[model samples]
Target: MSKATFAGGCFWCIEAAFSSLEGVNQAISGYCGGETDTPSYDAVCSGKTGHAEVVQIDFDDAIISYQDLLTIFFTLHDATQLNRQGNDIGTQYRSAIFYHDTEQQQQAQGYIDALTQDAVFDAPIVTQVTPIDTFHSAEDYHQGYYQQNPSQGYCSMVISPKFNKFKAKFGHKMKP
Candidate 1:
């Protein structure tokens, strides 16, 4: 199994998207890329903790390659949008890939380069590709939030669109 950590706006949407995939063993919604010892959702949301809402995904490489995961990551959200996704606007919502190793970093940079060359977006991709730091698990209520609160205002308004897009594009790759 291999792991990839990413911050693409709300962790709930990213967690739900990757968790639904076939080879993904787990998709943990948490906080990372910050200086705090243990950051809370409220603290991160305030943009004072310097944390980004991230999801740590564990998956089988034999079933899904890192490149494939990176591709899906790029497509699921607006990478060109800096520090925000939809109605949620804050540093916690920044697009980032917290790479575990040099290989992951290279692949992430390569994909960003390819996307830029292909003009994937009208604006430049602002997604940060950085090394992994201490990942502080969020409060229990934050984990599996979308699954538990499917009809909640934020999930319905902000997360569902990305979920729908992933389902439309990668549904066949998901677990049966």
Candidate 2:
């Protein structure tokens, strides 16, 4: 198994998207790329912890490549928007890929470069490719939030639409 960490906006959305994939063993909501030793949801949301809400995904490389995961990451959120996604605004909502090693770093950069060269977006991709830092798991209630509360307003209004788009594009990759 291999791991990949990404911060694309709300960790709830990212967690729900990746958790549906076949090769993914787990998609854990957390905080990363921050100075805080142990950041809570409120602390990160306050934008003082320097932590972006992130999801740590454990997956089998044989079934799904890191590059594939990167592709999904880019598709799920607006990498062009700096420090925000939709109504959510802050450094904590920035698009970032926290690579575990040099190889992952290179792959992420290459993918971004390819996207830029191809003019995949009208705006420049602002996604940050950085080294992995301390990953602090969010409070228990945050885990599987969408799964547990599908009827909630935010999940239904925001996360569901994003997830549906992902499912449409990558339905073949989803677990049966």
Candidate 3:
């Protein structure tokens, strides 16, 4: 299995979007790219830890390539949005790819470069492509949140719509 980490907004939304994909063993909500050690959800949410809310994905490379995961990630969130996604605002909500290896880093940078050269969006993609650091798993309540709290307001109002869009676009990649 290979691992990839990304931060595109709320970890809840990112977790939900990637968890259903084929070859994805798990999508864990966490914090990364920060100075602090063992960052807590509250500390990260306050944007004081410099940690972006992220999802650490474990997947089988034989089944789905890292570039494919990047494709789904870019589709799931607006890379052009800076320090925010929808109404959520903070550095913790910034778009980022915490790469695990040189290959991952190259692929991420290449994808961003291609997107820019092709004029993929009206606004420039502001996603930070950085080396992977400590990944502090969120509280247990935050794990599988969308599945566990489907009717909750945030899940229903925010995550669900984004999840639905991802599912619509990548339904073929979803597990049975």
Winner by lDDT: 2
How displaced is residue 16 in candidate 3, in Å? 0.8
On residues 60-103, what C-alpha lDDT tens digit does candidate 2 reach at each position? 99999999999999999999999999999999999999999999
Error of 3 at 162 (Å): 0.9
Q: After superposition, how far is residue 61 of candidate 1 from its true place, in Å?
A: 0.5
- 97, model 1: CA deviation in Å? 0.6
What is candidate 1's CA lDDT for residue 55? 92
Give the distance in Å from residue 174's predicted Cα in candidate 3 to where it truly belongs.
0.2
Task: In model 2, state the lDDT of residue 138.
Answer: 91
- Please give, for residues 1-176, the per-residue lDDT of candidate 1 as tens digits: 89999999888888889998989998898999988997988889999999999999999999998998998898877897889987778889999999999999999999999999999799999999999989888888877889899899988987887799889999899999
Pairs with steric clashes in candidate 1 = none
* Model 3 lDDT per residue over 29-142, tens place: 998998898899889889899999999999999998999999999998999999999899999999999999999999999999999999999999999998988889999999
Ranking by TM-score: 2, 3, 1
- What's the CA error at residue 58 for candidate 2, in Å? 0.4
